[model samples]
Target: MTCSPDDFRAAMRRFPSGVAIVAAGSAPHRAGMTATAICSLSADPPQVLACLNRLSSTCRAVEDARFFSINLLATSQLALARIFAGLEGGVSADQKFTAGVWRLGVTGAPILEDAVLTFECALVTAHPASTHNIVIGEVRHITGEVAEDALIYRSGVFGRWTGLAVTQPHLS
Candidate 1:
């Protein structure tokens, strides 16, 4: 038997992904949102893909900002992650970053200073992907923790650092 739509979604959610809040903006119009669907689409050209809802405010910001940043949240950044995730509803794009610890990337997108990693990128391509659009970005700048662990989402909750264990054998 084929999996129902809900079953497919449930199964997909079981696979944990590194949490990241992708930011894009131009000063007062900046916007960001938490995303767990970003992934490497190509290694040769240093490209990655992010999926964002077409109607999301952040999605609109990305369209006009010319650049985007992926801030890989550390395990300790759960609060920041939640804030950007829109779990508490939307806030003015500028206001959202006011309380968070962030610094500007080369592309001018806000990069969380405490993030495990951050990638500043320029849009390369975009295509329709189900209810969202798959944005492919060309990595332009890279910074942040080379050794820090990443926060993860699993079973609709966050509290894991799988990257820490995988990267540091000493911790394993």
Candidate 2:
């Protein structure tokens, strides 16, 4: 028998993940969503992947624009993340963007100016998965350097990374 949605969600909640905002489009058509399903896919050509729900407006915008941005959030930006995630006091989609300073990237997608790391990417391909689509983008441009601390989500709670207590002994 297949696992129920509640079972799957509870299991997934045990995994810690970084928070990000996936943005696409411009002006009146822009769309974004808070996501924790983003990850690096390759380093050779610089690629990244962001998984989005198939029925989300953000997903539709990304598919239509053929471009999108993955803006990694800083620990201080939890409120902004909540806005984008549609959880901040019921703010509407169009108004959610007002919470942050946004700038157009090379791909014409909105990039959060204060993001710890931002990747401007061109759509590569998308693979359908159950209730979501794995959207792959080739990193065409990037903004900001990695930050010391990042916003993390786990077990329905958000936290900040304070760096590792023990440093790595070796370097690549």
TM-score of each: 0.88, 0.92
Report the number of the highest-lDDT candidate: 2
What is the alpha-carbon lDDT of model 1 when measured against the actual structure?
0.84
lDDT by residue (20-131, candidate 2, tens digit) is 9999988888889999999999999999999999999899889999999999999899998889988878676556788889989877888998899999999999899998
Candidate 1: which stretches are off by over 4 Å?
Answer: 89-92, 162-172
Candidate 1 has its poorest 10 consecutive residues by lDDT at 163-172
Error of 2 at 77 (Å): 0.3
lDDT string, candidate 1, 1-172, tens digits: 8889999889988898999998998667788999999999888899999999988888888878879999888887888888887666765567789757777787888787777888999988778877898988999988885465788898898977543334554553
Please give the lDDT score for candidate 2: 0.90
Output the TM-score of candidate 2: 0.92
Q: All models: lDDT?
A: 0.84, 0.90
